[model samples]
Target: MAPAATAILRETFGFDDFRAGQAEIIEAVSRGENVLAIMPTGGGKSLCYQIPALMGEGLAVVISPLIALMRDQVCALREAGVEAGALTSANSPEETDAVLDAIGAGRLKLLYMAPERLASAAALSLLRRADVRLIAVDEAHCVSEWGHDFRPDYLRIGDLRRALDVPLAAFTATADEQTREEIVARLFQGHAPRIFLRGFDRPNIHLAFAVKNSPRRQILAFAEARRERAGIVYCATRAKTEALARALQEAGHAACHYHGGMEPDARRLVEERFAREDGLIVVATVAFGMGIDKPDIRWVAHADLSKSIESYYQEIGRAGRDGAPAETLTLFGPEDIRLRRAQIDEGLAPPERRAMDHGRLNALLGLAEAQECRRITLLGFFGESAAPCGNCDLCDAPPQLFDATTAVRKALSAALRTGERFGAGHLIDVLTGNATERLRGLGHDALPTFGVGREFSRSEWQGLFRQMMGHDLLRPDPSRHGALRMTEAARPILKGEAAITLRRDTIASIERRPVVRALVRDEDQPLFSALRAKRRALAEAASVPAYVIFPDRTLIEMAENRPADMDAMARISGVGAKKLERYGAAFLEVIAGEVAPLHPARRRLAGGEAGPIYDRLMEAQAELARGPGGTGKPLSCSHAQLARVARLGAADADMLERLLGERRAERFGAAFLEILRAGD
Candidate 1:
């Protein structure tokens, strides 16, 4: 590892050791190699670029997808005493001005922006003026048209990279083989990055799935078991999220709903609350939870099936982020499958993309009905192999498996005999010998396949049909009002040349699981609460999220260890030297029941090599304010102007005049240039 990276890792970020793939990634980024790192959620993707930003020359421009994430990370970086700012639509004019001024002054090391901003000519001008040396793309999968969260604005990033001619490092938590290729084609434009596939396993998360039986009741029961722990319940529709959130509230839980349809301010409020509050449940659509950095979320539940296996993994991966045991419960049903299928079919995506989408959904359904470890199935989808994990629902209570070959054959025969003009409901009705008037009118009751499946109950047959869909043996044809269509895979089974097995979906009473603590031990609970209270007060005073002040994991460590002094506190995991110097005293007092108090002018210069230079420039500007003869009109430059002068390498009277204007430069320009030269 590079010494500067190691120093920043320990003193700036407060980590003695790097995570699995971070050291290698940091080394490559430091070497200015184009890198594409596919790490799991909570795998420290931000640090890969952040450490490089601190060590590299010129500004590091980070293109992100969400404004809330940019704001949060900017706050956290500032708290760590790093010179970072964001140019986003959410900023007030004054905030934007400050960011521009900082950029002009060479005072910001990291600049964050939403990808959409890059489309503006003014934004491009600002980047060129900022002299960005590195481009880091977060949520890099967004660049892929084949991915679930494709952003058209992201497609412009390659052009920007070429114009800037800087090495690019792209990072994301979700990208399969196809999505990865699309990303490379779109972002790198043929030149591939040094790829790092840090496996997709989140071992701390315990995965579980259930067939939806009164899904509302199931979700409520699950929430009740983990009451007072932060969790997310994702729904398929905005209306469903609103209804479910209300239901959760009625059941006496602190719950709220989020979706893209909500006002931006409302969405921002929910994002803020999610970052600041603990034990609050957020019922939301897939629109929520991207770029969320909060690490104490205890669980995630899906009230509806996700659109794809990648979506499922990304959603559930939001939990147990602190490497603590977090759990997931996904409730899927026939309706969810049908709805997902219809959504894909109705989208404007090309036929091939639609087909790929269906394949992805089938993979998810296969996981839903997995007979072995959910982890194995999930990881295997990302081209990994693993033994059966003891943490999934199937491992906890193995399902009753049966030889389903005969039932599948009978179902396929019924579909074929019925001319495949009906959906599973009607086909199932015909198979169970339901001699409705319509069936008799069509003379379908006389078919040999009719009544052949009378042995299985209607619900059992429904489950079997769902499993068949999961197996890709049957498809719902949108052109025919979702009629049952047999795939080639079903022919062998229908012909008795193939056999299939399925897990019988049984509706059982909800088993109450023991409530688990969020993170700290029982004895440390009170201290943790106190520490959180302290953090909340600090964050509120600073007008930032609680995690921006110090994430829950750091506070949890504080509560558990109770470091009594600054030196001891600095040894804590997240107590980087800057944070320790800025906040270590105040937090130490809370731990011991006990405390830079830097001027704003000097504070912003903390991490860069320009702090002392800024101080000297300030002194020079003051000394020459009234001119060398001490007879001119009193004059002074702003802190920004002083910072710009301090950061300059070679300067002249004309340049200083342009920067400071005629009179002020005439008075202070000579001294300023001399000081800058001396520092050089």
Candidate 2:
């Protein structure tokens, strides 16, 4: 008999307890139910599916987006002795042979592949023979065309699910309400799954933001404090990554740069070094973090502001995955905001999407110039509320606030007087009493709003303009070369119908501190290092990443508890049964412890007379989808409708017609009723 869920969780995963909301989701999934779990990035999402795979009888196919992610996960599962393998374009002939042999022998319990593989007929045929029982989609938000990480190949998942007729569980960390609805429409065919929207709070990560003042120096200083720690520095452009990597290296640190423009071999080498070596820094663009599985990232620094709040949360989430404290510093300026606006306005998206993109950016800016706790502003974006988190910069050092209503009004008037065709630079020139040649050329020196406010310096005016953009009072028009234009939301402030306030920019007064604290106590430091050394040796011998053997958190637990025997070692959080059998002796010497069927839709009504009736009704519906002769305009009944018909205890032509519509009933009412009555 198959093991119970709790037994599998204890023996295979070594966790004595489940995190908040995990037990309920696992229970639903174990019952062969479709699930959509939206948990935080480091919230142990992989375990929800992994445990089910271990408890079930058939192979659970995982649809992943990247080969790197698949490789890391498969290796980790094998370390726990779960018998996992992956098929990707990067697989060698010998490796593919081994995975195929394992599948044929029924020795593999989990199979990981990319979404693009679902389009291949050979892959579908192989899955049919493999007796697949469940489909788990990682990064399921990629199925939505409206999402930032949308993948065209992900749209094929729904078709694959229908072909296999299996229950599917989709998991993602960053889907909002619109994205969630899109996922349901595309993936589950509008059939809502048992969804679990866990809290979005990752309280272990500290949040902070600073306006750009020598951003290079700012990033450098931030890095120097956390020296010899694994971190990522995200840049806005390719050139910036290279320049910053060089600057970091010149400061006598091990730093490298990565971006999409690099050669595939070069990128692979960087990925290897990052996984194998500790204390290595990689300065990269947004393309670097999606597939990274490292859990000990000490920090993440944004050299330039992120595109939106979703992107920001996702990027920063790479740090502190071990449930340890990590820090984030994001630097922004007026130019950064302008660049983001121009990028959004100049895109080829529809007007509605452009407007939504602008709104998303405004949300990020609001967090940047926030006058209260950063965590509150960040979490509020995802429709959650919480008390003040005393870990952010605002909580650490609250900002000074001032009523900038008059200042915002003056900036709006300058844009209006100049025909709203100038960028922030020119507007700043006109507002700060600077009669530059461009302003003189435009003949704007005698306007009513010109030279009316010279109290603030040029820098102060620039800061105020940034705050105005944050409040969404103004937007940059791409058609006019990024000219600042007032939005409708600004009309109230300009007409004195509303008021505004902003945090006084104190860039020069901010101090630097050590954000990266020691992960373990000093007494346990030596043992932790020893455990890591052993892990590195094992990973190198197996030609896999060090994290594949054991994550840093597991090692920390081992060092702290100092398990002396196999049973005690099996009690640690990450020490599964397989791991205890394979490496328990060595770790003890080091004083370690620790550790779908049916139309998928109609099949949900299984285990009763409705199952066969649903199938017959489906056949009838198919026959009538194009009318009696199959030459009229196409019509069909939804899966939900067919299920409803199958469940009816007694049905006549009129009742079937009511459920199946007049045209469908006229075409196949007799056959549909015959099948329904037989089941009754």
Candidate 3:
């Protein structure tokens, strides 16, 4: 009835063979297999339907949540010589008429629209008349309210599928057993669809998560390490997004902020700049990162904790789509949990839902604290079992651990002895037996367990408390902002249901610490200022955040290496394709004496500033590079602030009290100070 699908794949799409699972799905859809494809972000999910549409007698309909994504897909389809067009709210009367005409004339092979658009009776009627052969839902997890990025309107998708009586392929990257069931219930009306999950692993992108301690400073320190790589930094609110973007710019980055409050024109400029520019860092709220086609984002960083694990996975999935190494970094503090809890408590969801959300948050926290392979923890969260992934931070550099049964019991007894009314600080004091005023007033010094924990330092007690929280033996009551409370699991630790072993207070990892570069000149203001000038020019020309153009690390590297030409510059690791082409001449001019083009052949993860940390950085980079909010996670402070705290080892409640304000130190103080001392 129409051109064979293989013909389109071979001739129109210019491909000799389909990727791993495309043909199978296409054949299933061709034979009318109702399908649910759980492919990773860059797994060629589109081809499943695109190839089938080319063979079908009628037009294939695609439902996408992002207007930008729809437009890009349509344009790409047309470029492949396929008659494809999209209908969105942005369409004018003329544009709408033209698309309808193409469909009615049977000239259009594919049509894309958002699920919200189909709610209109007019759109439904048009679908009734149009020979809609297959329905492809991109980011289809939205249909399930249980999903992290759930959209209520997406619940209407199954209705539309039934109305058209067509085979539908529901697609998403992170659907656990529960989410998969929810998707089926919503999309297939309680019937299971053929499921294909192509091992939820993106080996190219390395994943890393860091607790936010002095967010702003840590951000800079982290970015400085991989200055020339592209990345995204996410914040929670529009205000934080704006503030962070400005701060990044001042810190010598071409950073641009994006939020819904900005005029559409302004947002579009930021978007274009980010898309075209290599190594661009976009600072924005969740309003930023959906369906963006930017493929080169090498890292994703969250200044805060995400609302749910689903959001975390989806946001981070944006990186490494090009099958190259990228990093994903998230900096979270204690306040993030509070904010997320407050959001869930206030949402329309029921109490059960709220508790479920709390559990999920705890899972995320556990994942963060886990010393095992990060990928293993992540897969476990999604209801899929995975053995240790050696590529993660924990695997590459394992943490120190110790049996802390005695220590944990001392802390628990202190909490119980104090009747659980005191805070972790007061509790830790009783264990390490710090004779603070509160301890003396409470007469804890007279107790048997008091000072028994003197064998361990005060900071060790603090680390034990954090690990306990991760184990779910302790929870901070929201009303009290995490005043010590015993969860049901506490019985196990207290009564030995499980033996408590703790990670040896490994607050210090060498790689996590800042290394002062020996080769660089100190206080070389003139040269440093010149470097900033180069960064700004390159950032503006590429329309990316200044750091994306040339992170401080790259600039520092350039000043040290002083490569003479494109070739030598290329050899300076982190200077990838778009970089060498666009800003090559300007930098080469600076180093003209040694000018010569290095081989354009790509480099590997070998000896360089980028070699060791590239993969972890890429995971965080992709997570924060999603549509609006980047990672759409909660906020701490600016990256600069985090680095500052990390440099200063402000450990425990008292040191945090002295160094950081009561509010400032509590969130970041604990983590950053740990990192600082450990690095030292």
Candidate 4:
């Protein structure tokens, strides 16, 4: 069994070995045991079930939450020569028929469908006949209402599991202890499965956070430095997505905006474009990254603060998926923290749940202001421990800290003396002794705390207050419209018994950053561009995402190695048998500066055994262009039709005529059938 699994890993998926935890999960699932794998984003979770599916009998039913994800996985599986199909509403009639046909013929090894499909009686009936051997659920955390991305449809998965009576394997990147219990309660009905808690640390991703200083320019500068890399810039609001996208585009970046607010078609177009196009930056809200499976996203930048530590981890996890060194930058300010706090407080959750939510946000803040290693704090929040990682901003350039006990006391005193009903701006003004109409009207100018904080400048006091919020000593009261209020943690500091330290550099004062390390050298830029151009042309012509043709990592390898032939190109990672056969010659021609008029239709069939037969069929049809007697009008079948016929090996004229129709079949059916028979 091990030998067969390894062979499948190499021959079918082009991977020599399973990633760290994948082999164990695959083995357990192959042995007919249930599995719950908590792997990281790029942790090869798909293979845990994919390999098992290949090893097991009958079809492996995959329950995915998103159509794009299902489509991507199916396309990738087909590219690797596995028999996979998806039953999605996004499918065209021809696509649906093909999937149904594969199921009926027992030719499909993996069948992917949305969780919503389980709601339909007809869909459930179809699955009943599918002879499902295992049920694999992707993004399995959605089953839990406590999870950030809960879906009501995922509740149907447990019913489907019992109906199929097959071993179930669930996969997700983010599920806390509460969410995990909820998942088991709902999906597994309180039964324990083989739970594999893979570590959440994504060491390949460089985590950095900055105070939002000229945020637009900061983001633009980041984009300009990494000129043509595929990255995502997540904004807090839909309006921000559009605005930031326009800013990046105006600054001469290949950028677009995506949000849930857009029309479905428009959002899909962006998703497709992002998948296909390299060096294209997508400025999106949190709605964008959940279902994305693109592996070569070089970086992900947050223009604003993420809602929670899990969210931050998930968003940044979208980068460095290929296990290459990827970078992330999250910019946050006092305003963002206030907004996040208010959002959590304003939610309709119960008091205990809201308090837990606040604690989650505070954990994220601790990481942002961490004087030690960011990774340690972040992992620690998830109940893991790690040494200081040198990759984070705090580790690389430690912030200068100063004791702010006196300053915080002054700020806290001002808030208390002023009734704690004003916002940060008003509080700051009173602390700095500013005489204004609002202060005069409130008679807060007579307060002793006023003018006593004159030792610190207004900006300095603002930074101190921000640090107070970071320490959980102060919070913006939602009931009073973001009024500054002291928490229990502030008592000791207010009494001068406890000391607090603050970073001297305010978030807004941190200077703009230099360029990040580029993925490729300057000299290799041209070759990479040319390779991307070839990939784009092929993808556009085929109406598939460019990554489906060849991912960036593959293209980078090609650009670096400048593979001289099929054999050399075949050795590149991600250059599977099918991809090498389909794209090797075209890329080679580009690298070697040779011109090849690759017929668009023939290109689709290039690497398969049927490629030669497809060419023969095309030639036969061209010869009969004017019909049997060379007197009729020219007619031909589409390349897809010819390729299908070639692969189907239709022997008789009846089968050939059925596929090509009467007129075109009369013109070329005899010769096409002859070619198919001869090839056989």
Candidate 5:
């Protein structure tokens, strides 16, 4: 609708035409209409304001909460050759003055700042002088008191917009109808806007969940199947972040730790390293990495339970930002649920906030124990109508649901027969026909319901109980470590007052490769391998990992584009200025002409730690192990020392100390003195 917007969209944003909902949103704001845009993440939310700002008659002041995201968006605009700048906490006085001067001169198109900075004299003076075209608020949901990440400053944003006397647009990835209404009341001061509620559907990511049974093993197996894949593993605390990171590395993953606990500088370094990788896994706490800009991350996993469903969805949306297939795995159990509940119950949140938090937590629990398509369940929460997405775990491999009425009656009878005094383990034994000493000692084998539940195995019964607990149909007695305690919902199932049906658990007869969500058939291998070879060759000369040369999304992009020339190759995503200059010629040659076959001496993963004793070294360990020459890493440390040091990150040194973990101490010992003295 706007010529300047059309030109910018075509050359810079790479769109041939406007998406279904964009042109209208752009036109409204350009015509001075206040607007609310509820686009999904990776949707064109930025454009709704950005296009209008560029084409409108005056400057648009964009208020944002995250300094990191502000910097990234500004950088992208600058890269597109637009006149945009950010007023941030990181800017020095001189930098701030320069930015203010540019805005006053009408030389800046978009100016981004934190809401708290509205009080600053420099920011205020600039906004007063510059003709404000549109006031754009990112994360508008933060103005809602019930929303997570609520900030007091966000409550004042409406006043700021009114004082500036500009038509405005507020955007958020989440907000139920109630939350959206509250956002309008609080953010725009009851002056509602033209609303755009795009459907919430991240169809690229496949959702899955597992109960916490050997969670560590489950995480390792998940990462193993996604070997050479970029992913995130979220931990509940900083210590857990580091522990899981070390565990993944020791198991031969390129894993690293990140959290708010780390020094800012250290966290920045880890973030920079991960941004360039195809498969670098970052194990982190929730407080860190709010808006990572990397687009190639293939999956997101939770080693612990998420606090709420909104949080869970936001986190999982990080995967498949490029619209490639990705995976999400969340493993949780009763202990996690209890711990989360205790935190909520003990927190200082207001009564209404507490009620909203409980509702969100219930939504997350429902997702984990759901029997239908995970995507459908997710969209339904956001009030969007979504048909079953056939790609998720439940849709692909449909579970067999069985009538659990008979099983429920038997379990209730057995519990009552045993005086409801025993925990789940004891109750399970009574139902599974396990004539254990405890059962016989209590003479509970004589109960009418005993042996009646033999129709289902122990696993099926446990799944039923877990889902039942999730649904609030049953309770777990906290004092007895979650012993089954029936509530009113259970009475109906047991007494035929209600009929209940539940899906049978998929009997995992084969040991599943936990992380292998999508497997590439052999027919797609040649092109994939050839594309990888090109990526590797480029990475080698640059001294970066293969993924650093081009993320998996870039390789997939290349396979999809197959551009026949250098210009087209340069236009591919992730082929920025640095890559264009460094690896352009060699890569173009591969795409244009490749006649070579595999040769005997040619090997990838030459530096892979698993291939040799030297390959076992993490990059830091490699630096520490260097002897300036050809001294093999194995000869540098005594075999006993290497074995002793493998146990470094474990809590108890006495356990697995026989393997690796104590290298520094054991190396300095007499057994390794000969090697150290020789400097080998």
Candidate 6:
């Protein structure tokens, strides 16, 4: 008598069929079994619970950790014509009343709340009257103490589930064996749930790693190649996020910064802009990108190394969630590796835990230094085997390698001769025969290995040390403030009993090539630009995120296909009935050349009261080009200059003159001031 899951999948979600393991998980959850689903990021995990909720009898309560995530999902489900609501501190009083009313009337099929809300008795009493039949835990790994994003509030989820006596379904993208065991024990109360371990292989995402060489320039170059696409740049520190964002903005990208230290409102504004704007890059610390559901992020770059392999996977997984081709670039260096080691060694975790953490970082280093396929090595870390995916940088341009057994031994001998109590800088100095006061003070001039590696340049020796760290033959000693120390793996090489080959290309010079290829053709670039213009206008008019109008993937499809009418537009992947109805005609007009592409400066001020104001300001400035008496030479401000004055609403002549300077302000200040006042 129940409607089949396949029917709901097609009619509601517009998918022809369920993705791998989705149908099975949904069926199990629908049968009232507690479920633990370890699906990959962008692997359609939401549907595993959404469809079952719709097929069942009462409201499915979802416990999400992030307020933004809850609001995003609630909006998306509503757009899909489903009855969903979220209760959070961000919700207005009227919104909360409406959700409570929906629950009392049994009109809502799904209700979303944060894990912290379960701690309040009032929230529980209210939920007790809502006819809740299912509890869904999103980002369920946060409940485990060993997880990267541990939440004290997540500990309350198990008690809530037992109090409600409802079926619980848990989901996360990055959970290791220990985290998974903790989740089962805590949430399921030691009773094993029906587990679905979808393999963690994102074939659509191209992977690449680079050692930091002119890191700012490297990141800028990466952003330039894929201009006007949504991307995220992750930094290791809050200050780096701000600095990198400023650098990116000065280089003419619509870049912004986000971190936990920022005000809540400022962080929320950045989140909203990133969701809505096109080609906008967010340089952020690890504080960002936990539960962001944006599907069209074209690329993710690490301005610095991530803390762990799990952190690396989760950070890069934010891109290409729409099942399109996305790219990733991670830059690491000796300094980054040393910082990671020190962080692990200095943590309050037990000795065994610190050992596990070191092992994990070693795995990440192995992937970075991999000679064969980066993808295979990455997957193997998660207990999955993969073929040599041609999508990674290593497979595309195989590195040129050479016998480096002699070089590695020399480096190891230098470290040993120096007492293994020094960092890479001093070690490199000793290898390159660079005599310093410190080296002389330590009496390193008399050492046997001093100046023995002068055949290679200083930079070359640095690269050799980096490769050594990557090989786990050398690690930073945290107790001694990051002194170089040899591991067991280096013993055989030091004894001349083992031969090692290192990448010759990496030591010679850093490769500056663009890792991501162009997704669209040269010929279709014009169309792509036009489509982006249209999306921006629509997003500004609606005051929503640009992707809310249409994601980059959808726009790319529109450009490639040149959809002639509504019927053709409806067939595009993201153009559901709602989007097709709202934006179909405007976009079709762009494809048909019915609209002219606006200038980039004007585009920023378009689609609101500011558009007409900008036009008036431009007209006023043109009139004042030759001055009020029409007796002086033509003097004008640039479009950017005009736009800044207009957007800020320079109220009077003094403010206007301050922005345009005394000379140009003398000619056009009064006129610009008049135009602004008229708009106000």
- lDDT by residue (1-680, candidate 6, tens digit) is 13578756654554555778888899899999999999999889898999999998989999998888888788777766789999999999999999999999999999999988988999999888888999999999999896678999998888988999999999999888889999999999988999999988998899998889899999999998888778999999999999999999999999999999999999988987887777889999988998998988999999988888888899999999877789999999998899898899889999999989988888888888889888899999999999899999998888889899999998999899888999889988888888899999999877888898889998888888999998889999988888999999999999999999998788878584646666678899889888888888876886666766676777878889887655466566566554554566689898874644455566544433566677788888778788877777999888888778878754777777778899998888777777888878
| Native-to-model Cα distance after best TM-score fit, residue 51 in candidate 5, in Å | 2.0
Model 5 ranges off by over 4 Å: 92-98, 349-356, 412-423, 429-460, 477-484, 506-555, 566-590, 593-680
Candidate 4 least-lDDT 10 residues: 506-515
lDDT of 5 by residue, 1-680 (tens): 87877756754554446766889889898888989998777566787888888786778889887766676677666555567889887778997787778877888899998989877776676687888778999888878775667777887778778778888799987778878998889777888888998877887788887777788888988888888888999988889889889999999999999987798778767876776455799999876555565566788889999998888987887887766678888887766676666566567888777667767887888887778888878888887778888877778676667777777677777777887777556777888878998798888787776777787778767766666667656555556555666666577777788877765663222222333554344554566668777776655555454544555666676666666654566567656544544455566666667423211111111111211322243322444453335364542444444433322322233333344445543432332332323323
lDDT of each: 0.85, 0.84, 0.70, 0.84, 0.70, 0.85
C-alpha lDDT of residue 361 in model 2:
93
On TM-score, who's better, 3 or 4? 4
Q: Regarding lDDT, does 2 or 4 come out ahead? A: 4
lDDT of 4 by residue, 238-348 (tens): 999999999999999999999989999898888888887778999999989887999889989999999898899899999988777788998988898899998888888
Reference-based lDDT, residue 115, model 2: 92
Q: What TM-score, over all chains together, does every model reach? A: 0.83, 0.83, 0.71, 0.84, 0.75, 0.84
What order do you get sorting by TM-score, best first?
Answer: 4, 6, 1, 2, 5, 3
Screening candidate 2 with a backbone cut-off below 3 angstroms (N, C-alpha, C), the clashing residue pairs are 166-596, 167-596, 569-595, 570-595, 571-595, 572-594, 572-595
Report lDDT (Cα) of residue 579, candidate 2: 68
Q: Which of the predicted structures, 2 or 4, would earn the higher TM-score when compared with the native?
A: 4
> Which stretches in model 2 have alpha-carbon errors above 4 Å?
1-3, 507-514, 562-568, 585-680
Q: Which parts of model 1 are misplaced by more than 4 Å? A: 505-518, 562-567, 585-680
Q: What TM-score, to 2 decimals, does candidate 6 have?
A: 0.84
Alpha carbon deviation, residue 6, candidate 4 (Å): 1.7
Candidate 4 vs candidate 5, TM-score winner: 4
Q: Which ten residues in a row have the lowest lDDT in candidate 2?
A: 592-601
Candidate 4 lDDT at 358 equals: 90
